[model samples]
Target: MLFLNRADAGRRLATRLTGFAGPDTIVLGLPRGGVPVALEVARALGAPLDVVVVRKLGSPLNPEYALGAIGAGGVRVVDTDAMRALGVTAREIDSTEVRERAELERRTVRFRGTRAELDLAGKTAIVVDDGIATGSTARAACLIVREMGASRIVLAVPVAPRDWIARIGGAADEFVCLETPAHFFAVGQWYADFTQTTDEEVSAALATTRVT
Candidate 1:
């Protein structure tokens, strides 16, 4: 199924997640693209929305290839097999992580400013993203939320590969996806307008939700 944009995808994804709507449930979006999609879900569910800042640790050789991911509260998910196969050393991984961690901090500050992070203690956290590709960032987000004391975790996305569950099934208690296309190539391929979401757009989305 092709989506007009992230908003369209989020509305579709929210339909699959009606069971999660409640006071105890909170929606966390992976910025900056995920925020738009998640905003729609939050509106539909009447759940508080927040950002789960995570960064993809790209391989040293091929920057597009993810070696792992890092999230808030020092949560990290490294792919040992991928590192060994790519001949990536510990030093290389450390360097990559350092770079990503800095960006993650910057984004957190930019998006959240001085606001305290949402208290996830004993609450149900629904992690939302526009789509899943490598699934590394989504996994890291789940771990971060779990660390924050969420009682239950749900990973929701609009689209993913048919084998996506196998890739990220262990991260959350429940997984809700709108589409798992068999011939999936990339997340952007399924969207008519896959425009890059900006920091301002993310901030605006958060600001609007904070008041409502």
Candidate 2:
């Protein structure tokens, strides 16, 4: 299935998640692209919208290779087995995490500004994203939401690879994906207009939701 844009994709995804609509359900969008989609979901569900900032901790030797990810509230997820196999030292991991944490903080500020983070305690945290590729970021988001005391975690996305559940199923209590094409290559390919989401757009979306 092809989506006109993130907003279109979000509206479609929200239909499947109507059962989750309630006061206790909170919707969190990954920064930038995910925010627009999540804004629609939050509107449909009448749930508070927030940003879940996370950063992938790339390997020192191979920057493209993620060792794991870090999120807000001191949440960190590391692949110990991969670290050992790659011979990544503790110091290297620490250094990488430090850098990623800095970016995560910067993004959190950019998206939420002075607004205090919404409490997820005993709530159903619905983590929304534009799409899933490697699923590392989404996994980290689930881990972070759990650390924040969410009673239930649902990882939702507009589109993903056919085998996405195998890669990220363990991270959350439930999953909702609109499309999982077997021939998926990248998230952009399924969208008719996959423009990069701007920081201003993200901030505006959040502000609109907060006011309404």
Top candidate, metric lDDT: 2
User: Model 2, 6-76: lDDT tens per residue?
Assistant: 99999999999999998899999998899999999999998989888888878898876777888777888
Off by more than 4 A, model 2: none
Output the number of the TM-score-best candidate.
2
Give lDDT tens digits, candidate 1, residues 40-157.
Answer: 9999999989999978778887886777778776778787998999999989999999989999989998998777778899999999999999887787788778878899999999
**Residue 83 miss distance in model 2 (angstroms):** 2.1
Question: Model 1: how far is 12 from its true place, Å?
Answer: 1.5
Query: Worst 10-residue stretch by lDDT in candidate 2?
Result: 203-212
Per-prediction TM-score: 0.87, 0.94
Give the clashing residue pairs of candidate 1, or none: none
Residue pairs with backbone overlap in model 2: none
| RMSD of candidates 1 onward, in order | 2.4, 1.6
lDDT of 2: 0.89
Show how many residue pairs clash in every candidate, following the order shown: 0, 0
- For candidate 1, what is the total of clashing residue pairs? 0
